[model samples]
Structures are given as C-alpha cells and as structure tokens.
Target: MRSGNPRDTDLWEWCCGFYPGSHPGECSGGTAATFDQARADFEAAWRLFLANRTEADFQAWRDHKAWTAEKYRRFDRGERMPHDWRPGQ
Candidate 1:
C-alpha cells in the first residue's frame, strides 16, 4: 500500500478585511483547490452559524420574558412584593 501525499489535500483558512484605507467588509475562505468547492463550503457554514445564533438569541429573549411575567403575576396575586412597592405611588 502507498501513502497519500499531504500536498494533495486541500486545506484552506478563512480570510477577510485587510485593506489599507477602505474596509471592504468582504470576506473569503482562502485558496481552495477549486472556487466552487470553497464557495459552497463557506456559504453553507455561514448560513448554519447564522441560523443557530439567531435561534439561541430568540430563545433567551423568550425565556427572560416568561420569567418577568411570572414575577408580575406573583405581585398581582399578593404573594410577594418588593419592599419599595407602593400602590399607585
């Protein structure tokens, strides 16, 4: 059996935003063996990351609102109130 060559493997790193004056705000995963392959990988990774992050943020917001609602319900039911609480003051 023959061993595979390391140079035959396509390894790339993501690179972006290195201009002197203008910030292009553009990014690319650099130097793939083929442009199509690189673009496919980058776009897929970007979309997956975006979706996951957005979902996490939304879930956190929903949990916080639920906790606040529960606290307000307790106050309305006269279960407990803060020491600074006063009626319509």
Candidate 2:
C-alpha cells in the first residue's frame, strides 16, 4: 500500500505474509520511502523469516494456508458448513 498523504504515512508499505494463520510478530512486512524499497524490505524480511524456521514449520504453514483456501472455496461454491465453521478456523 502506497500512501502520500501525511495523515497516513509518507511511504510505501507492503506485507509479504499470511494472516489468521500468522501469530503475533509472525508477519513479514515493511514500509519505505519508495515502492521498490518497500518491496525489497519485505523480501529481505521474508528471507530472514525463512532462514530462522525449519522446513517442516514452513510446510505446516503452507498446509494450513491451503486448508483455509479450501474452506473459502467451499463457501464460495454455496456449500453448507457447520455453524461453527469460519474462515481460518
């Protein structure tokens, strides 16, 4: 997200991680004066994140994300789910 208005932020911001599955401080993102800089920052953060985690952990996150996506697809198709079913649940 790029913003020029002073009320918001005079920089470009970007998030390179998923949510609802991400715990606090698990998301990778950053803001910079330019769009390219912001994207570079996000990429750097993502690389660091990968370096800090095991392959198994990354795979687990991928599986969870896929599951969440499938739920969303089912909902979109008008399939009925239990009342307790919710996105990311």
Candidate 3:
C-alpha cells in the first residue's frame, strides 16, 4: 500500500506484507520522498522478505500466504473473518 500523511505531504509511505485485514504481520514499510521511490522501496522490502528467509521459513510463508489469499478472497465476497489470527508470529 501507498499512503501519505497530511502532516507530511512531501513524503510517501509504502508497505508490503501478508495482511488479512487491517492487521499486518511480517510487514516492512518505509517513507520516501516520492511516490515512485516509495513503490520501489516496498518492492525491495518484499524481495528482502523473500531473500532473508530460510527454506523452511519460506515454505511456511508460502502456506500462510495461500491461506491469507483465500481469506482475502472471502473478505472480498463479504465473509467475516475472526480477528484473532495474526500471521508470522
């Protein structure tokens, strides 16, 4: 996601991760001077998330990502999800 704070209009904030709802897990984000930079930074963060993982950890994340994707699809279809599930913890 890309966003800007009204109080800091000159900067852009970007984030990437597996988020099932408003809650985020295993997330990385940062601020940048321009929208393009923010987007690039987010992509870099995502790459780092993959690169830093052990093989086993990556497998777990893939599983979690699949579950998260399905949960997101269900949410798009208007199904409610329980709030207690926090990924990557």
Candidate 4:
C-alpha cells in the first residue's frame, strides 16, 4: 500500500530522478490512487498459486511466467473476487 502505484512507480521515479522522495505523496502514491484500492488488490491475490498448492501447481502458475502476467493483468483490471482469490489474514 505504501509502495506507491506499482503501475506508476517508475513514472514518478523517472520524474524525480529517484524512486523514493522526502514527501509521502512522491513515493506513496497517496494522491495517485486510493489506498483502499491498492490494499484490496494486494489482499485479494497474495496467495494465488500458493495456498494449499503443490509444486506442480506452482510451476503451472508461476514458473512459466504466464501467471505473473495474469496477476498484473488482474491488478490493472481491479478484478478482485472472494472465491477467485483470497489472501490470508
């Protein structure tokens, strides 16, 4: 939530000539996107391909990199579902 928009992190870094700046708004993406939005996304997908998962599932989901791509795509779409994804508390 505090890492700034993962989407826009590089943009702000490029503009500021660095990643993290002194002001919270600079790197926190506080003004960029709602914190609630980011938090919701992260919590929804933190356990994708990990919970009750086997190594084969891990490979199928993450080793080929397609799953990583899918994850970001979901983030971009703000697609959060309770049955679709649920990170541990």
Candidate 5:
C-alpha cells in the first residue's frame, strides 16, 4: 500500500502490524525494502498469533470471515492469493 509520504511508494511497507487476521487500517508497523522482507514481518506476527491457537480456534476465526480452507489450501499450493474476499463475502 502507498503511504502518504511519496518516498514510501517504492518501499515494501507493512500493510498491518502484528495482529493476526488484521487488515489495512486495523494495525500498524514499519516498512521494508522488498516484499519478502515485509512478508517476513507478517509471518512472524502470524506465527505468534497461531502459537496460542488451537484447531478449533482457527476454525472459529474462519467461520465468520471471508477466508476459507479452500482458499488457504490454494495459497499453500502457491496459487495467487484470493482478493475477492471482503466483508460481504
């Protein structure tokens, strides 16, 4: 996402902070030079979130959200991440 600062446009800025299931504007974090770097921060935060979760916990999270198991599977298989999932979906 582009930041208000024009210099941040080319940087791989973190879209959200360490909160799992967080979307843009829900949290905050720093930036990086590349996507891999940005994703590393996200993954680290996600791992921390998952550390306290059970299978049921994860299921519960998905139950009311746009993300689904099938979509996650596709993501795990290296498919392009789904973007159609939104509040109404």
Candidate 6:
C-alpha cells in the first residue's frame, strides 16, 4: 500500500483509510487503482531514489510528523511536492 496515494499517508494512515469487508480506495480509474498507482509511483520513485539514496534521510522523513503532515496536505490539495515523498511517511 505504497503507491504514494493521498488516501494513504503512511502505513498507519492507510490502515485507517480502509474499512472492514470493503475494497481499497482509488487513485484513478475508479477501482483498486489506489494501490496500483502507489505501486507504480514507488517503483518509479525507487529508481530515482537510487542515486544518493540515504536510509537515514528517509528515516528522518519518516520521523518528521509536521513535515509529513504538510506533505499529506499538499497532496490532499492536489499539489505535487516531490514524488519520493510519501504523505505522512
């Protein structure tokens, strides 16, 4: 559940976004495209992430609550900050 979709800001956010016995949300295409698009973003972002990749930096982002929230808000507003940035990650 990492397609970098707005509906899912992070692992916990994504878990909360779902309801029991319900289907996943959508990024587009009005289907499970929620996961599909996130996967696509992750794969593409992964490649770009290879250069100067830093587990620590990513960890820093993971632990940044305010920054993450800002990120999520950006996406929620249909704004693109950066692809590597996963909302509230």
Provide the TM-score for each candidate, comma-separated. Answer: 0.30, 0.58, 0.43, 0.23, 0.42, 0.24
lDDT of 2 at 5: 60
lDDT of 1 by residue, 1-89 (tens): 11353767565444432222222443334546665767677777556544444454545556656556766988789887465644332
* Tens digits of per-residue lDDT for model 5, 1-89: 54576773557766433223343454546677778878898777656655655676545456544455656767889996556654334
Q: Which residue pairs collide in model 5, if any?
A: none
| lDDT, residue 7, model 3 | 61
lDDT of 1: 0.52
Q: How many residue pairs clash in all the candidates, one count each?
A: 0, 0, 0, 0, 0, 2
Candidate lDDT (C-alpha), each: 0.52, 0.69, 0.68, 0.40, 0.59, 0.47
lDDT of 4 by residue, 35-54 (tens): 56555544444343134345
Candidate 2 accuracy as lDDT? 0.69
The RMSD (Cα, Å) of candidate 4 is 16.6
lDDT of 3: 0.68
Q: Which stretches of candidate 5 lie over 4 Å from their true place?
A: 1-4, 8-10, 15-29, 66-89
Cα misplacement distance, residue 86 of candidate 2 (Å) = 15
Q: Stretches of candidate 6 above 4 Å error?
A: 1-33, 54-89
Write down the worst ten-residue block by lDDT for model 3. 17-26
Error of model 4, residue 45, in angstroms: 3.4
Better of 2 and 5 by TM-score: 2
